[model samples]
Target: MLIPPRVPNRREDGLLHFDLLPPLSLYVHIPWCVKKCPYCDFYSHAISSAVPEERYLTALEQDLEASLPLIKGRQVSTVFIGGGTPSLLSGDAINKLLVILRNKLLLTPDVEITLEANPGTFDDDKIKAYREAGVNRLSIGIQSFNQKHLDILGRIHDVNQAKRAVEIAMTHFDNVNLDLMYALPHQTKDDLDADLTMAISYDPAHLSLYQLTIEQNTYFAFNPPDLPDEDTVADMQDMIEMMTATAGYEHYEVSAYAKPGRACRHNINYWLFGDYLGIGSGAHSKITVDGKVIRQTRFEQPPTYMLEAGKGRAVDEEFTLSHEDLGFEFMLNALRLTKGFYPEMFEERTALPLDSIRPYLKQAEKRGLLYRDPTIIRPTEKGMLFLNDLQQIFLPDE
Candidate 1:
């Protein structure tokens, strides 16, 4: 049971200085889904009648209470309740959770609260209830509108249902994001185009278009489906970006698009290396206290998390970041943005000198994996394709 030690505080220029403390966000994981998608790799379990929603909510509140000491006085500006279909919970249950968050955390009036909703689970009443519970944003999982693609992806909703879900979401929430997947097995360009057009027709404020990937432990992994060729996948990506841009959406991140001023702030916080607290089963968090970055995780199993509620012993482990590790992490996330971070942000966030990362920047620039202007460090087209290689350049020497 060894734990990583926290870094010692140091002084700079006769003034006490610690690592930069970024703004905090909160992530709540809902681990239950109606049915697992074959290509999914997230930590979600199939739903049963024995979900124990009331008890789970109680455990979540207690979990927040125990973590209060660490997050005291920090104002939470964003909260994303993501999952195996967080919309499965009744509106009352959702409201109860929000009530607990408001009571325990410093929730700003304009905080962006996003709940992940599966199309099949959302109804008009549930949508209105969720809106009433203070959820301002909805990210609906509408993977594809093609019936064949839907079946292949194991989505419960049909094309019409998916369209209806978006209409319902827009009616209830001002900001709505549609999640779509492309490059499925035997999927044609026409199929991809139709899905994108259907998604756009709904006039969602944001879009998250992801490429389907086969992951380990999924049914697809054991008997992998014949996926689209690499060239075809690339074509799909190109077409999606073109269509989305033509429709006036900004391709902010690789997979995300947004209307003006509608980018997901919580995800931006993550890409910018801000602090966040992760609550619920199998959640992970990184927080900054007095300049030390503290990383922690909660129990992964539902029963274990419930059993350890209020004891503060639900955490599997806690550790602090090393200086070198922090730099790599900061850049790893920051570089993902098409518009890379400002030069001064590195120093402000990592408490490290600008010169510390010069060598990596020079190497990456030479390889055309990154673009460096006088003020910003952004990834080039080549860099985005080989992101892992670009990130490896920042890793600490062994």
Candidate 2:
């Protein structure tokens, strides 16, 4: 690790000081997919021809080189390769990319490296190659086992393919995460129950069950499908909680469940407001320098991002976090966890006094939206149900 020069917190000194910095992670994005789903809003482009795998890898290398200055010496605790379907890249491509990371970055010895894969894009050999390339975890996107729901969501894989993907991943990796979505158009409690049952049957190490929502630019938003009523959706949520609990899974986050010690460390770092450096097209990064926090983003389009990255200037936008921004941002993420955060972490992460947010904390507790004591600050049952309202209590006044 390349340790940066540290200075004292004294204002008189020229340099800034952070007594201790948060853990760091890395996120690599692959922006090409076989097809873009209508309801998807992430910046992923559909490839009509072969993927530009080699060019994209080179661009990622350049982006990482440019970013090393900001994170000199800090060991990356985790690396998550997410995307348009990172599985689309050939196994050799993945190997080369991981080699680049190993050569350039000071990664922790037991770094939790995860790669996101789609059923339609991988085979036994490909999955094996990823495991050989130092990827210790695999997160497979299996939206639904029901053929109708799979088609409705524009997923390329069928029921069999989804099962095969999981089987193959289980063979190659011990740590796996299966993603599923509930509250689809015209879905019912029974539909969700079936999906949950199928997912639980796999006995995956981690489960990320999300509720589908239409975003402004998504196809579902424009041509809205008939969705279940709020009450019906509520029942589905309850059923999910009950079933997963019965299956011996712990609901640690809003939409995540895991076996003992199997929670995604990468995601946990995010919810804890830890720093991460994102590389690749359309990636975003948050880093803390000295005592100030900075946010950055690369260009959204693949072509544009690749072009800029070759010049060692992939970052398109950058900004520093303000005091109010820090307070709101911290709560926005940390509050998502059912376990909440430690009070001292508020000061450690945001570099602000804990007393700063005490009034807002009191307000949330008064409204029965939060419960805080010396040991920890967590959400109550009501707070979890109305999480948006609870998080809003800490928002900076406009």
Best model number under TM-score: 2
Error of 1 at 317 (Å): 1.5
- Candidate 1 backbone collisions, by pair: none
Give all TM-scores, in the order shown: 0.94, 0.96
lDDT of each: 0.86, 0.90
Candidate 1 structure quality by residue, lDDT tens digits, 191-249? 99988998898788999998888899998999899999989988998898799999999
| Model 1, C-alpha of 278: deviation from truth (Å) | 0.6
Per-residue lDDT over 291-395 for candidate 2, one digit per residue giving the tens place of the 0 to 100 score: 688999999999999999999999999998876668779888998899999998977887676676777888999999999999899999899899999998888
Worst 10 residues of 2 by lDDT: 1-10
What's the lDDT for residue 102 in model 2? 95
How well does candidate 1 score on lDDT at residue 201? 84
